[model samples]
Target: MSTNTTDIFTIRAAPGTDIWRKPPTTNICNAPTAIPPSTRSTGPLTSFLSACASFSFPWRERYDQAGILLAFRRRSESSDSGIPPKWIKTGIEFYQSQPQLSTVATDTWSDWSVTPLLSSLPGAETEQWTTILVEKSEDEHGKSIWVYRVVVDEQTGEEKSRTALREICWVYGLDGEWDLEVVAMAARPEKEVKDGEEKELVVKVRGWEVKWEE
Candidate 1:
């Protein structure tokens, strides 16, 4: 029998008050830190990353996000238990009744921040499609950092706008090293039951790539 099956699977987060999977660390989101040099040799490296798609959510629901997410757990931690020590998800999210660029990072706990998108047009039911780029870089101090960028592209794959986002340390573990995983993530925070009709929320992601460092 052919082992291959022509089936599709989706990874979905449960609907909640918010999409955040952890508790708040503080009032202010902590700045990202640098990856330890020792870990660099073994290289939990990632690059040339991208994701693109269009999605629809209940207008102004304040509970939907779809894009690229990178999650890391300390190398010292057990692979069998608990959430990753740090993670970030970047994409279009509904907030304050407007769609904006949202990136939520968690270390020990979670913190969310938003940047207004240049693509957000007035009085639109949904915003335009987007591309997210994730890459690794070094600071003047020679520390390793992760850079996130939001790009707007034309239908022909021509560049329209590219906005460089804040860079954070590629590592989150203080005691030792970290194990990293990158994925396409989507979430819906609210459940809508309109007279027993299930409102199935969905998001799409495409054109993703991951190139390991040499």
Candidate 2:
């Protein structure tokens, strides 16, 4: 495959809450079909890019469809009326299915795109523990865009994967993945992340972003 520098860019950050605002270090996982890189206009491209940022549309529509949701219900039974009990954790079959969440109001989860039309969005400074968002839009020129945010964590060591230093190390583990590919968008000031107990903060993590047109 040929490489195109025009659409690729990257953002860098130090640590702690300032990574947002930073542009993402984007590398096209795969180019779209029918459209060549040389033909699209920049204005449309910028608008499209911003729209992509607005909505978390999937980069790959095929084999990218999946969602994990968790729900909680009170154990208390009804007095007179009978309401059927809902699963303590009724949601996606993968991650949410593994852990039973009866006591918790929110179900913890990990998943990728539900459709090839969807792509995986990553969180700010991630190693695992990424945040995810969906790309919801009607069509181009119609106002609406696509974007995504996903995170990951080291389930075994349970290490905090949000640290830049640790993230750098994590990238190496991915074999020069630049590792930031999944979560480049959220590193922006427009986004923030929740770590253990610390509050989320706006960040300046930009340099590259992903955008596509049809």
TM-score, every prediction: 0.68, 0.20
For every candidate, C-alpha RMSD to the true structure in Å: 8.4, 21.2
Per-candidate Cα lDDT values, in order, are 0.50, 0.21
Clashes of each: 1, 68
What is candidate 2's lDDT per residue for 6-102, written digit by digit as tens? 2322222212211101114321112111122232222211122221111121111111111111111232332222211221111111122121111
Clash pairs (backbone) in predicted model 1: 33-169
Give the number of the best model, judged by TM-score. Answer: 1
User: Global CA lDDT of candidate 1, please?
Assistant: 0.50
User: Considering summed lDDT, which 10 consecutive residues are worst modelled in model 1?
Assistant: 33-42
Query: Compared with the true structure, what per-residue lDDT tens digits does model 1 show for residues 1-81?
Result: 001111222334444423355533332212121111111112252332223333333334554566656666655663633
Clashes of 2: 68
